[model samples]
Structure formats: C-alpha cells, structure tokens
Target: MSRLALAIPLLLLALSAHAEIVIGLVANRGVEETRLDWQPIADDLGQLLNQPARVVAVKNEAELLASFQRGEIDVLRGSSKVALSAVEGGKGEIFARLALTGRQTQYRSLLLVRRDGPASLDTLLAHRQQYRYASGNPDSTAGYLIPQYHAFVRNNVLPERFFRSVTVGNAEDNFRALVERRVDVAVSNTDDLPKLAEKYPRDYQQLRVLWQSPPFSYDPLVIRRELPAATRSRIASFFLDYGRNGPDATRAKEKLYWADQLDGFLPATNRQLREVTDLQLYDALFRLALMPELDTSQRQSREKLLYRRYDQLTALLGGAR
Candidate 1:
C-alpha cells in the first residue's frame, strides 16, 4: 500500500480514538463554578479512557433533561431525582453513587432558624404560619423534596398553606436569606451546613437547626444507555475504582473534592435508588392533592391515590425507618 493510503486509515483511527464525551454536571452553583468544580473529574476520566471528555453544567433539571433528550450529554452526576428522571425518560442508567467527604453515602435535609429566633422546634412549628421560609429549588432532594414531604405530607402541615411566604432558591441563596433575616427559616442539607459555616462562620453561627429529615442516600452517577456496552463498563469501572485503590488513590480522593466535594464513588445499581424513587413518587402525589383546580370529588380521588402510593412506597422503603 502507498504511504498516503496508510496515512488515511491512521487519521481515521486517531479521530475515532478521541471521540468527545460530554458529562452533564448538576448545577448546584453557577455554570462557571460548576465547570471549575468538575473539570478535574472530567480530566481524570479523559485520561483513564483515553478519550476527549468535557463537562457541561446544567442550571436545573429541566435543562439537564433537555440536554439528555438532545443527546448532548453522555454522563450525568446529579441528585436521585435527576437520575431517576433521566432513567425514566430513557436517557441514562444509574451506575454508581457519590459519597461526600466525611459524610459517606447518607445525608439529611435540615430546617434552620436563627439561633436567637427560635429556641426550639416546637416553638418554630407552633407559630409556623407567622414566619417566612426559604427552600431549595423545586428539584432539590434535601433542600426541597425531602423537607416538603416531611413537613407537609407526613406532618399534614403544608408551608404553602400555612407559612407567611415561601421562597425557592439554591442552598447558598436560601442560607443567605436566613442569615440576612430575609426568611425566618431555611431548608438546606447536612453537607452544605459545614461548607456554609466554613465560608461564613459568623452567619452560620447565627443559624440553628430546628429539624432534620431522616438520612437519605447520596446522588447517583448515571451513564447514557446509548453508549457502547464496553464503553459503559469502562466508565463504571473508572468511578467504582476511583479513590479506593491504586498508586494514585490519594490523588484521586483530592480530585474528588475538587469535583464537587465528593469523597469517592461507590458501585451502585438502579435498585439502590429505590427509596429516592419512592420519595419522588410521594412528592408528586402530594402535589397533585394540593391542586387548587380539583373539585371536591377530584380532590378526594387524588387523596385516595396519594394514600395508596404513600403506603406502597412506604412499604417498599422498609416502612420509612
């Protein structure tokens, strides 16, 4: 064969070898912040797979879903809500769970009030209607979903119906609202509290935990189902083995911190996300029950549906601990 013919095949091989893989990062912060946080992980994955990998920060679940639908993202790291949504939408499959540094694989949602404001949880719950509240985005697990389910559906006290007002934002925004006295209570997660304290000790000191939800599992790392089986295996193995063993184990742990405060990734399956799926189902049913447009009959039907699902999920989740 001529040299030119050989070069043509070599060029094709090089092109195939460097195919770009886009990993969608859940935007807990601004796009730039998310990019900076996850870049190390992206680089590490690229090195491990010998492929060009990049990170894409999605502002919310909607944006993440859109990206998946457009086939723009090949990997995802996000809350269980986002991961389950992707799987249900036929976009991805849960392959591993992200464990936070010092937190392991479980965390909880917290309700916070100024230390001087509410002396006790009873005091806060007693006059709940008189105070404003700040919660995380609607899609947030610890910040919104878990708290809402615990405070509203489980307790039969809906903030929307009883609180003075309810504002939705990110963890930092909600915590800032609490510290600034913009809202009387703020919903955040166990992991975020320490970070907030570390960054704003004075403000964090002003806040006290009023209540906390039961421990919830860490978010899962999802891979696009469309990828080749071998490629998927490589991706799964990379995360599962990261920070666990090898000469670069220490460096891998450090890199995880740079990639969104993670300690490491643990091997996980879709079955491991069962509880989160149950939570999501319960949240949706509760929301349906609150639909103002529903008539008496419709509302009753929704209530019945909600109760049925609540029982089913509760049972599946091992009777809610």
Candidate 2:
C-alpha cells in the first residue's frame, strides 16, 4: 500500500471526528420558552456551525453549576447568580450578557400577598405575627436574598420576628404557597410573575404585586471554556445577530424585551467580576451571620466551595493556570 493513501484515510478519519462535536446546552428556569420553542435557536445554531446541537434541561442552578464543573455542558443560559459563579470558577467564558429591560433594565424583588390580604409592605411587616413567609430559595437573589436583605438586613425586620414561619423553595412553589394560603407573603421577582400568571391565570388572578425592589443586574450566558475559540465566537455572533429576531421572529419578538424586540446580548467589558464579588461579600456579611453553624469545619468548607468556583473561572478564562 502507498504511504500517501494510508495518510489520506487517517486524515479523513480525524476530520470526521472533528465534525461531530456535540454542543451541550444547559437550561435553567428562566429560558422556559427555549425548552418549549427549541426549533429556531437550535436550528440556527446547527446551521451556523454545521454541527448537531443538543439542549439539556437542568432543574436548578446547582445542577447547572455541577454539570459545568464536570464538563458535561458546553453552553449555559442561566441566571446572573449562576453565570457569575461559573465565571468565578473558570469553567466557562462569558461571550455575551443578557440585558432585560423594565424600569432601567433591572429586575425587582417582589413581596406578594393573597389578593384579599393586607396591601402594603409595612402592613405585611406589622402583620408578620399573623402570617407566614415563603421565599423562593435561600440562595436566590430576587426571591429570598434581596427581599430578606431589604426587610431584615436593612430594615431591621428579622426573619423570626417578621414571620411566624418561613419556607424556601422554587419560584413556582413560592407562588403556590401564597395562593393556597400556605404562606401569607411570598418573595419573588417581578419579571418572573408574568410568566407564572400566564400559565395559571386563576391562581395568578388571586395575587397582586404588593412591593417591588430596586433594579438589579440582568443574567448572562456562560459558554464552556473548553469549546474552540472559533465555535465560541460563532455562538456569540449568532446570538448577537439573531437572538432578538429572525428564525422564530414572532415568538422571539415577544421574548426579547427592548422597544423593537432588539434587546440582545451585549459582550462583557473589563471582564468584571463585580457581581460575584458583591455576592460573596453580601453572603459573608449577612447570610453567614444568620446561619447557625454546627462546626467551624463547615464554614471552612463553605469558603473552599466558593474559592473552587473562583479558581475554575480563573483557570478557564486564562487568568489562572
């Protein structure tokens, strides 16, 4: 056999392997539309790279973060909280950040009560003795942390003193708790309530937005660092170009919020780690102090856990080896 013939076949095999890269997409809660309406984005992405794109629905932020650490996912459409964590861990790269609009492109923490109940934050505060409080998750920014921060951390309304009881769960669960009278006041985000209402009109009709918080930052999409630079850039370009409109133009129009549905992702400048830094600082100053620790080891473990994320982000972004 000729050496040239053998080399040609070997090169063809290598090219075949290169062409079949499977892009893993991790889905968290917010992109509910993406899971239901996958065709346009997936097809567009597939057409762009000429490779198969698979969307994997992840249940929560923890699962999404875990998958990124194990190198199981190639791209993530996630919350600011989770994306920033991925950025800090060095497991992913930030190609573009999502910009959500409404009262300054920021989301507010809302405190909701039953439709027939007291109508104000102070009213809820005074009646804390008579009602239970439910928050999305302890670690959730809009659902639990921010609301509690304002109510307890800033306003001197302690969790124990404000509510007769407290529960932590998913966003849906928080709303459910309020509707079913499981809790009197449920803390959640204003941006999320619309979708929740759209899904369950009856239940939603019974609740009202009692209080809203100041605008916080929007979420960003995190791409796994191991992906080829070309692929990363292409994905970013695809989103920048068609994320707001084109394929599922009508639905995409509804989803992207700017005046003309032109609200698309914008690239991060300065590679800022501000969100993660602020969160850690807040977690330490507030959340940590609120916890009842069983041992000093747990505290150290907590620090290491957060640092591990930072190390991963640093390594992936080329800041760390």
- Superposed by TM-score, candidate 1 places the C-alpha of residue 57 at a distance from the truth, in angstroms, of 2.4
Model 2's TM-score against the true structure:
0.73
Cα RMSD to the true fold for all candidates? 4.3, 5.5
Model 1 lDDT per residue over 1-321, tens place: 699999999998778668888888766556788787888878888998899899998667667767876888888877776776777666788888888887488989999999778776567778867999997777667777888888667766777887899998777878898999899988888877887787789888888898888898887888999877888999898888888788999998898887667888888776665767667666777677668898989878877876786576455434554
lDDT of 2 by residue, 1-321 (tens): 599999999998667434533333333233454354444455557777777666665446677677777877777765656666676666776776656544234568888888798878777766657888887654356665666666556665668656788887666778888999898888867666776787789999899888887777655667878776777788877777654546665555454542212356667521544544444555455555456753677866776776776665454445632
Give the Cα lDDT of each candidate: 0.79, 0.64
The model with the greatest TM-score is 1
Model 1 TM: 0.84
Error of 2 at 5 (Å): 14
Off by over 4 Å in 1: 1-17, 284-321
